[model samples]
Target: MRIAIVDYGMGNLHSVTKAFEHVAGDDASIVLTDDPIEVAAADKVVFPGQGAMPDCMRHLEESGLKGAVLDAARQKPFLGICVGAQLLFDYSEEGDTPGLGVFAGEVVRFPKERMHDEAGHKLKVPHMGWNEMFIAREHPLWQGISQGERFYFVHSYHFKPSDDIAVIESAYPYRFAAAVAKDNIFAIQCHPEKSHNAGLQLLRNFVHWDGRP
Candidate 1:
């Protein structure tokens, strides 16, 4: 199988590519490419991103891979990470940018007033580091993973789907969608590649998933 890790000039491509390599081994071909044709031809796609939303959108279009990425997300077993997840929505509060509109939702930032924990300690804006995730719904990508699994996260904005497609939920003093699934697309706010064993298991499950929920 050919797996494309899209390089849109924004994500932590090397580490994500390496993690997929470790999990996929010799069973699938993992290619990190900026070429739209390569992304379109792949059997599955891993779309990862970091930094600002505007920048991610800019690079995606500027790199000329937006169409291919959208096609892959709709047609194959596609995985989106971090800012990659946010971009799946129709719009984002960040820079007032628009996205691929594959999913109906708006990406919003964590409320600054609610950033404080129960003890009144102010949490960071990025909401960096590890946090436990509640499995709100079942999916093939979540196979073998238990509830409350800690996943590494580094983001300020989160996806709020218009429907009940959120499969994973977490909180930074407030509940929000940590991951969402629809048909062949599965996207997460956390960086599974950096989540250790539990993360590896998720990626492993993705490698074998037939895009069925």
Candidate 2:
């Protein structure tokens, strides 16, 4: 499949490309681009990012990728990582700025207050390192991942999707949506590229997904 990795001058473009390469084999073609035409024509789209939400949104608007991404989400399968995922929502408290408004609800920060007692330590912001994810129900994107699988996550803000069934939740201080899917659109808070086997499999599934929503 021809997967277009959207480069709005803010994505973790190279690594994600490599991850696709690993899963999709040599025949898989991956390209980093900001061209809306190329992006819209792709079989699949990936929005990868590591930065503040407002700045990322501004770059999207400036690069004219905003419309292309939204249009692609409407037409085909799309995946967003970290800040890219957050942008798919209506708004984020991260910067009090608006998002692409593709999905309803807001992105909020991890509570500064800790909840420690008998279990262990309280979860903190920037839910870094390896964390376990429980696959919520059944989504084609997570077909092979079993219970208690760990994925790499590095983020402070989180997306609380309005669609409950679409959310695949993982833990931190509390359970937050680790990944989300709505019809043709799919998004992940963690970096699949950095998650080893489970993550690669997730990317592979997206590549092979028939865009059935």
Candidate 3:
């Protein structure tokens, strides 16, 4: 099997590539490339990104991989991480940018004004560190992962799908879409590559998944 990690020049590409290597080992052909043809030829596609939405969109557009990504999301077993997840939505509040629109949703900021916990303690905007993920829907990707597993996260914006059923909610102070799955596409706000065992398990699941909904 072949797996391609989209290299849009915005994310920690090496770390993600290494994590996939650890899981797939020598059984799968894993490559990190910006070439649309390489992405289109893969069995699975992983789109990972970090940084602002505007910059991510810009790089995706300029790198000439945008159509390839959309096609992969529609045709293959696709996994999107962090800003990659946000970019799947219709639009984003960040820089008022638009996304790939693979799903009907909008990405919004974590409300700087209300960045406080229940006890009124100041909460960080990035929402860094490990956070609990409450699985909202059953999917093959969540095969071995528990319902309330914690995953590493580092983001200021979160996706809000118009269809509530598409969301796997997580709480910072309030609930937000921590992950989303529909058809052949599965996306998460967390950095699974950096989340240790659980993360690796998810990657393994993706490798074995047959792109079924």
Report lDDT (Cα) of residue 201, candidate 2: 92
When 1 and 3 are scored with TM-score, the better candidate is 1
In model 2, the clashing pairs are 183-213
Give all TM-scores, in the order shown.
Answer: 0.98, 0.94, 0.96
Weakest 10 consecutive residues, lDDT, candidate 2?
A: 115-124
- CA lDDT for candidate 2: 0.86
- Give one clash count per candidate, in the order shown: 0, 1, 0
- The residue-level lDDT of candidate 3 at 134 comes to 83
lDDT of 1: 0.92
Whole-model Cα lDDT of every candidate shown, in order: 0.92, 0.86, 0.91
Ranking by TM-score: 1, 3, 2
User: lDDT-based ranking, best first?
Assistant: 1, 3, 2
lDDT of candidate 1 at residue 84, scale 0 to 100: 91
- Cα lDDT of model 2 by residue, 8-103, tens digit: 999678899889978888655887888999998898999888899989999999999889999988888888888999999999998898998889
The CA-based lDDT of model 3 is what? 0.91
Query: Which parts of model 1 have CA positions greater than 4 angstroms off?
Result: none
